[model samples]
Target: MKQKIAVLGPGSWGTALAQVLAENGHTVKLWGHNPAQIDEINTYHTNRHYLPNIKIPTSIKGIKELKEAVIDVDAILFVVPTKAIREVAKEVAISVNTKPYIIHASKGLEQGTHKRISEILSEEIPESKRQEIIVLSGPSHAEEVAVHDITTITAASEKLEAANYVQDLFMNDYFRIYTNTDVIGVETGAALKNIIAIGAGAIAGLGFGDNAKAAIMTRGLAEISRLGVAMGADPLTFIGLSGVGDLIVTGTSVHSRNWRAGNLLGKGKKLDEVLENMGMIVEGVATTKAAMELATSLNVDMPITKTIYNVLYEGKDIHQAAKEIMLRDGKVENEFS
Candidate 1:
C-alpha cells in the first residue's frame, strides 16, 4: 500500500530518504526552509546544496511551507538536524490536526535541555495530537544510502506495532530495518556515537594509524554504553545497530561530520576553524556539550566525552587531553560489573 510521506527537511539525509520512499512508490513531499533548495529539487530533481551528486525522483515534490508538506500525509519523517527538531515540531503542531505517526531520523540530543528528539516531539506536539513516535537510526551514512548501498538500521518505538510498521515502510533489498523497543538506548546510542566519532577523527587527524583509531573506537563504545546504561537503557541495546553498529561506521567513515570535526581538531585546528571548514552540521560538537552535561548530572563516568567537551569548549589542548585520558585511573574491562 502506498502512503503519503512528509519529509520535513531537504538536506542530504532528507533527500535520500525521500528518494527511497519515492522509489518505493510512495507520494513524498519534501519540506525545505530555503526556497532556492526547493526550486532546485522541484525543477532539477536534485538538491544541489546538501546532495549535489544524487538525482532526486520526479515523484518527490518539494514544498516551502510546512503545512503544505503535511497536508494529508499519512506519516511524517522528521529528517531535520537535531538542533531544528523542536522548532519544526512546534510549527508542525499548529498545522497538523490529525495525529500522525512520527518517524525521527535526526540523531542528536538537544543541547542544554538534554532531551532526545522524541522527547522534544512529545513536548511540542500535544499528547492528543501525537501518534506513536518512532526512531530510525544506524550506521547508515546519507552519502552511501543515497547511492543505494546495502544499509541496515533499527526502527524503534515503545509500541511494537509502530516499530514494525516503520520497518515495513523503509525495508528493502538494499535498505534493511530491524524493529526494537529500546527507544532510549537507540536514541542514546545514536547521539553518543557522534561524540566518539569525533574522538576517532581526532586520532586520524593527529596522524595516528589504524591501531590508535581502533583503540579509540573501542573505548568510545565503552563510554557510550556506560552512559546509556546509567540512564536506564538496556545494556544489550548498546551492542546492536544503534549502539556499536553506529559507532563503528560513524567513527571510521570520512562522511561523518563529527569525525571530520574531530579530525580537524586533532590536526591542531580550533573548534571555530573546524566548524567553518566543514560547512555542514557537526552534530558531535553540540552533542558533546549535551553529553557532558548529561553525564555529569547522571554521575556517569564518561572520560572520553568529557575530554572531547573540554577540548571543544574550554580550549583545552588536544595532546594534553589525550595525555590526561591516558593518565586516568585504570579499572577492569567491564565497568558495569
Candidate 2:
C-alpha cells in the first residue's frame, strides 16, 4: 500500500532516500532546514549543493516546515545528523497526529549519555505516538544508492514485524533490505564503523599500502565486535552487513565523509579545518568521543578506537598514532586478540 512518508533532512542521504520513496509510489515530503535548498528541490528538481548533477524526482515534495512535513504522515524517516536527531524528533513529537512508524538511518551514540538513536527517540516520543523504532543500516553509501547501484542493507528492530515493515518499505532490485532483530548490534556496528573508517582513511592519506588498510579494517572489526558484545549485542551481528559490511564500504570509499575527514587529517589538516572544508558532518569525529566513553565505561578494550580517538581528540600526531598501533604488545589475531 502507498504511504505518506516524511523524510527529515535534505542532505545527500536523505535526498537519496526521499527519491527512493517517491519512485516507489509513496508520497514523500522531504523536510529541510535550508530554505534555498528546499526551493531548489521544489523548483528545479535538483539539490545541487548536496547531490550534484543528480535530478530528484519531481513527485517528492520539498517541505521547509517540519510540522507540515510530518503531520499526518504514515512514517517518519529520520536521516538527520546524530546530534540533530533529538531536535528534529522533538519537533515531530509535537506536530504528528498519528502513531507513525519511526525509522532512523542516522548512526552514532549521544556524546555524553551514550544513548543509541532508538533510545533517544524512545525518550523523546511517547510510546502512544509511535510504533517500534527501526534502524536501517549497512554498508550502502548514499552516493551509490543515489545512482541506483546494487546495494544491500539491514533493517533492525526489537520486534520482527517492525523490521519486516521497514524492509518492505526500502526493498527493491537495486536496493535490497535484510531484516534483523539485533538492533543493538546493528546500531552499534553502524556507529563504531565510522571511527574505524577514519583510521583507514588516515592510513590511505599517509600513503599506506592495501596491506595496511587491510590490517586496520580487520583489527577495527575486532574492536567493534568487542565493544558491541560488551553492550549486550549479538556477537554474530558484527560479522553481518551492519558490522563488517559497513566497515568495508565506509573505510574504503572516497564518498565517505568520515574517511574523507580522516584523509584530510592524515594530510595535516586540523579537525576544525577539515570539518569546515568537507561541508558535511563527519560522524566518526563525534562518535569517536562517544564510543570511547562508552567503551571505557563498559571496560571494553578497543585499541583501534583508542588510537583513532587520540589522534582525533588528543591532537596526537597521525604518524605517531600509526606507530602506536604497530608497536603495541604482540597478540593473537582472534576475536579477543
User: What TM-score does candidate 1 get on C-alpha atoms?
Assistant: 0.98
Model 2 over residues 201-250: C-alpha lDDT tens digits?
A: 99989989899999999989999998888888999999899999999999
> What TM-score does prediction 2 earn?
0.98
| Each model's lDDT | 0.89, 0.92
State the lDDT at 3 in candidate 1.
86
Q: Estimate each model's TM-score.
A: 0.98, 0.98
Residue pairs with backbone overlap in model 1: none
On TM-score, the candidate that comes out on top is 2
Q: Candidate 2, residue 255: CA error in Å?
A: 0.5
lDDT of 1: 0.89
Model 2 regions lying over 4 Å from their true place: none
